[model samples]
Target: MTTYIPQLTLPEQVFASAPASILLPVALGTTVGYSTRPKQTKETYNLIRQPPLRPPPWVFGPVWTVLYGLTGYGAYRGIGLNLTSILPGTMSVARRAATLYTVQLGLNLAWMPLFFGARRPAAAMLDVLALLGANAYLACLFFGTRDGLADPVAGWCWAPYLAWLSFAAYLNAGVGYLNGWDISDATLRRRKAVGKGAQ
Candidate 1:
């Protein structure tokens, strides 16, 4: 008697063979790469932030990890479908959306390096804008792809991404203003409060 190993169909095979963990680093690489600019940037950031907003630093890791998994899977679904007979306009839009999505992720990856590595909040703000723009376009293009069966899942996937980009935009802008304006006085107050256990 021999043990049998079942063969996965093509897409399943791709899904099954691909490790889900790969999404983690790619998602986190965005963070790590962005954070490498200079440690001092984070210092002033901490001083200015003082109390800190945006869901306490500890929460981001788990949240982004889960989000990246969803994002990668959604990407696979949105682009992996056969488009042999789809209209040219839709195809063009879809391709454009896919390109946008790729750019957004690439930008996402680059953002950390710019913000944290180089300590360039202004540059990070620029990158976040691109990410938001690309995601917005992808949402619309994918909207056209929506049908009775696929619309719910595909449309739903982009919602979180849009929300996330929006929040990131705010964060980037806020950081840039605080840093670029050189509000050393305001930062001192917050920094002092932290020392007093005000947070």
Candidate 2:
């Protein structure tokens, strides 16, 4: 006797298979960061001494747009892999990897507000460092070898992000150093007021 299996509808299959749930929120958060671009550009220009390797201000938007797309796609692919896995152990590992991805994404989202909105390079440097750490951890999770469940595509997808963050850490440190970033809130407010007056 043959056992009958229920077939999934197209929408159900797509809903179950696709990673939109994970990617959409990430894309939304990234979009929100664009609102801070003008402030970031102004602050960057006003820097007394930018790092030697700093890219043109215009480069950031395009670069991050590409990077965020890659990141979201990588995450979507990773989650797809997880969702289709058969074993409970595999599912657990995938869930852990997804969680790490979320943590790093949160760090990514926090950096803009700290750096541009608050104009606190020192604090932002700390956030960037933490972001670097999270990226590293997530990369390791994606490339884990001992279990033979490594997702090389997902792991390699983080390469550009990790490289960018390394450069950003250097730039953040340079900005913090050159600007003496330990100033008070009042000083920051006064500087912003003065900057607005000049513009």
Candidate 3:
């Protein structure tokens, strides 16, 4: 494929900048994590039937912080690159790759609410499944496969994220199966009320 060197636009300049790019996802992730009720998240995590090898609750914050940083860096790298030459009206490969990246980021932000805030394991599992699929495609796009743009550095940034998602999938499935896919606060309250009534 021919290399197409195009003028850098304002959007690209902003996203390609290190500080802005790196801070975007990190900030969003942190906000989502905190807004979703951190205390209840930890408490629910403790009460749930977790899979073997699940890390402690404290581990999540740091791990996600690092992952979001990498994600932003990857976006910076990918956005700054000259797009591979392609026909008009079909959308450039770079744009497609960028779009996929954004989609995966949204999926990433959505998981915490699904799993912790709403306490819907089944929905959370589905969201994770979608996140995994979308990210896999995104990784392919960034890595310069026939179906992807040519940016090895961006691809590498997403690799660790993929690995983490694999582990998360296992944990999500395990928790869903072990806990019968029901972990809502209402259910817990109902169970408590039933016990008191029986007494």
For TM-score, the strongest prediction is 3
lDDT of 1 by residue, 1-199 (tens): 1111122112322222224423643556556734564345445445544223555554555666656666666655554342222766444444444445555667777776676555566777888898888677666655553531133455567789789878878877876665553334454466566663342
Candidate 1 deviant stretches above 4 angstroms: 1-45, 50-52, 83-92, 145-150, 181-199
Task: Name the runs in model 2 displaced over 4 angstroms.
Answer: 1-26, 37-40, 182-199
How do these models rank on lDDT, best leading? 3, 2, 1
Q: Count the backbone clashes (under 3 Å) in each candidate.
A: 7, 0, 0
- Tens digit of per-residue lDDT, candidate 3, span 1-199: 2232333222555455878878888999999999998998887787777789999999999999999899788877765453324533223666655566666677888998998888888888888899999888777767765656567898899899999999999999998888779878866566456752221
Give per-residue CA lDDT, model 2, range 13-110, as digits (tens).
32134356434544656676667777644654564356687777778767787777666666655544664689766556655556556666777778
Clashing residue pairs in candidate 3, if any? none
Ordered list by TM-score, greatest first: 3, 2, 1
Cα deviation of 156 in candidate 3 (Å)?
A: 1.0
In order of appearance, the predictions have TM-scores of 0.66, 0.76, 0.83
Model 2 worst lDDT run, 10 consecutive residues: 1-10
